[model samples]
Target: MNSLKTVWAIAWRRFSENSAIAAEMNGRFIATVFYCTVLVPFGILSALFMDPLRIKGKPPRWLQREPVPTDMDSARRQG
Candidate 1:
């Protein structure tokens, strides 16, 4: 009875260890596949079509400065 219990305990330990390692490996593989297939392609398509950065032709809005108000413009505004 004691020997049987020992064997069962060892088997349970081995199974738990193997399951933990397998779960880690499968999780990593699934994440990589999702990133490559879904996230990466969506990012590429959005960059190409949506122009989020305004990189196609027009400069980004932050890079453009509003035209400085000239003295004439100030005078006109005052008038």
Candidate 2:
């Protein structure tokens, strides 16, 4: 009985010491999974649908056959 108690006490002590490390590892794994499965896929889908960079807004000047006139002529003149 004393040897069993000693083993149990040692096991409890070791578990107490390592609990923080074990919790931190679990937290990091969960965060990584959330980032990969949720955040990454959401970001990709949003980028696909939303055009965050506004790449579709205007053609590059070099790509345009004719120079496009600006709608804000007064602003251009002021600049």
lDDT of each: 0.89, 0.88
> Which number leads on TM-score?
1
**C-alpha TM-score for every candidate:** 0.64, 0.49
Per-residue lDDT tens digits for candidate 1, residues 1-79, read 9999999999999999999999999999999999999999999898768965556886557776688677887878876
Model 1 stretches with alpha carbons more than 4 Å out: 51-79
Best candidate per lDDT, number?
1
RMSD versus native structure for model 1:
6.6
Full-model lDDT, candidate 2? 0.88
Q: Which stretches in model 2 have alpha-carbon errors above 4 Å?
A: 1-13, 51-79
Candidate 2 vs. true structure, TM-score: 0.49
